[model samples]
Target: MSLVDLIARADERGLAASGLACLDRCVPLLGGDDEVLRPLWSSLADGGADGDAWGERLAKARAELDCADPSADTVPGFGPDPAPGSGSGAETETEAETEAAVSDEDRAAALARRMLATAPGDPGASALRAWADACSAAALQIHRLLDVAADGDGPLVAAERRRQVAVLELLAGRGAGGLRPALEVSTEGRRVLRAVVSRRARGRS
Candidate 1:
């Protein structure tokens, strides 16, 4: 089945797993450890995205990601409020321009956080559909932001889309046994992302 069809037919657990797997694979872009999202995956076991386990593990994941370098210029879900008595003229303008130059890592981190935060509490058909849609968009955007191509579509994005579909289809066909295979697919994507990061760093140097 196509990715859309698989998503449309998938049960709540399948939908949640599909989205989470995508984000988990891209965690390297956020400078997150591979194991950081492990607890959230555990929550998906035993038919349980509905319980507090998912929420609790999500909170922990967010916390772990957040604790990295507060002064770093990463994007949060909401932009920080302008500080009281903060300068409003040339200084503000300069700061605004500086902030506009968000790093690729920061942008990827924002997308990952969006996937985590927007996951459906109920994991019902409607909620899961919405969440899955958001994840698809976010995943695509993350790949786009990381793409180094000077002109049009790059190999990175093409591979990411293929990996996304493969993951969903794996779940649809193999059910729970597919998780490992799905993760293996994600691992391949993660390697591609890592190569992209390396290439960008080398260019910068």
Candidate 2:
């Protein structure tokens, strides 16, 4: 099926993983290694997996992927190794090549790509994005809420604020639909949005 068809179908029937899978097929077909793969992987790695679910999938991808060197995995088009004396300080990171570790951004990107490869249009695609986005937003929100509460906003005000947010979220969600269906397909990036919707729905502080 065409990409537009896949996207429209995903939006209708909620098949993010499947949609992503379709995109993966298109990537190579369209020769979008750097443009498509990089962003896709960025989103996936940043998102996450379902414990063993993620690991098993990665294993399969590893088997299929062909890297020039097995020791270190490199982003397809990123700049090469640092200059000989690139180390400013007398020390450097791990004795092993820096390539061993995958940065959060890189991992997210890789995961996104993998999702594209495995389950393109599945709602989990949004879920992955939500999860990644939530970490930071939740952290900040928690800190702010705590500080605000400590200042003695009292449960009444806090409660009302939550209610307001909830109403707003519900209205917004209603404009679309319920939060449950939205969260169901979560992966990493979209999990945070789900929580906010949840908080608004449930009137949580």
Give me the candidate number with maximum TM-score: 1
lDDT of 1 by residue, 1-205 (tens): 6667777888776788788878876777667877887777777764547888887777678678764332233454236767878867787777777767767667776877667666665566678777877787788778888876654557677777888888888777877777778778877777777777778778889
Candidate 1 CA-lDDT value = 0.73
lDDT by residue for model 2 (26-75), tens: 23222233233333333333443333444444444434443212234334
Q: Candidate 1 at 199: error in angstroms?
A: 3.2
RMSD to native for every prediction? Answer: 5.3, 17.0
lDDT of 1 at 130: 72
Candidate 2 runs further than 4 Å off: 1-48, 67-71, 80-205
